[model samples]
Target: MGRGARETVLGTLGKATILQIPPELQDLTRRFGEAVWKRDTEDPQRKLVLLKYLDGNYTNYMQERTRFHKSSFSLEILNTSRQERQLYEFIVSKGPEEKVWQIQLEVYEPVSDPSIQILGWALVNDSCTITLNCTAERGDNVSYSWGSWDTSTSGLCSHNGSLLYLSYPLQNTSIACACTASNPISSRVVTFNSSECSYEQRGKFPRTEHLVLLVVVPIVAVIIITGVFTAAHLAMPIAKQEHLPLAEDSAVHTIYSQVQRVESPDKEPTTVYASVMMPTA
Candidate 1:
């Protein structure tokens, strides 16, 4: 940390009421700090127990030690509190100009699982882009990781990380996503289902656009059908037309009979007359 940041942290630590630190903390520091470098210190359980007083993760004892002075040690409580977690610093030095072996300590609680949320989404053409988040109820010293969206893992729908990139035909289908929040002490997982997200949005057009199409398409069809019939009627050829003649001034006209043909050449020709109307004017 920088000097300014360290001083700022120290300034904050100074504001809290000075509660007397437990004397046993120094003894605990001494137990581990003094045994930094030695030979034949093979009592694994004893050393682990001693280390646990500061950090609980030291389950087994391993001799990864170097030259440490058991005589010169100073235990400094960098920051502390009675009811809450605290930070400690154990500094072991041989002399003013010598190397320093410092161990900073802090208490860690089990991480709580973060909640997942669909941050936002966009639909463009045949593809959809969706962003996700798992910051809600964030855990201490947390990390982020996302699960796969495939069938082998029994996951739902496409793509990686906190963003889901899905293809077309998303109707009748869904996407299941998993986001994990983890720390050294614990890990948590949160899942999200995009089925409902893509449920109402079945087709390319939304419900409102579909409604508009429903109204517009039929009107356009009716206009096209009407135009087709009109063009056909206009293109057809009209046959020659004739109307029967009407008598003038309500006068009756002469009637005509069909001509009779002679059976032999000697037979006389038969005369036939057709009714003819003459104009009064």
Candidate 2:
């Protein structure tokens, strides 16, 4: 099956018909889905059941299409690759979150050498959200295989045909979505890395580099402020060491002197004087 918006139904295509489907196509979700999708297609599943499931998927697809294009468009699946990986190729065109079905479904003839381009992204804020559109340059029907190159961070990334989301939103990470576009005739591969789009990324938390600035910048500011304060404090003395008012600031702040008098009786004034300064404090 092709990658639907949420559920990547390994779409077991039965056959295509142009007849008017009953409004009861909704009923097929339970009864019709249980019959065909329950197991891999046997005798290629029931034709009527698959058609009902297709209608449900197409209904969901149309809702998305109506948002961007009010006009009608065409989609055709080359029924050949359904067994290549027992998989299906979503025929998509340009735009963001382009419908996995892109347009209504039809069985197309096999074409060759499909060139692919990963186009615009549609982003939103949640855990993580980004949509990558993969379009075939030449062939419209080809399988798309998406994967993560980094085995260590593989679990963090989730992808469908064109949609990519990360389990963790704010962190340092390099995520890649590669689509191996192949058909019965030839195959080609194209890839895009989220890291490459820092210049173009959108959303609440597009990159983790912002987180680094949030944490590191304030610490550096505090260190600089403290250093400046300490320098300014040292630049001006709290008080001169020679002018300390507290005696406890130093062990010695007292001095003793002795004076000798030689002439005692005659003048009562003959005395020798010597000047001494208390050790600079």
Best by lDDT: 1
Against the true structure, candidate 2 reaches a TM-score of 0.27
lDDT of 2 by residue, 64-105 (tens): 211211112222223323332222222232223222331122
RMSD of each: 22.1, 20.9
* TM-score for all models, in order of appearance: 0.33, 0.27
Candidate 1: tens digits of C-alpha lDDT, residues 182-231:
66656777776656447465553344566689899999999999999998
- What would you estimate as the lDDT of candidate 1? 0.43
lDDT of each: 0.43, 0.41
Best by TM-score: 1
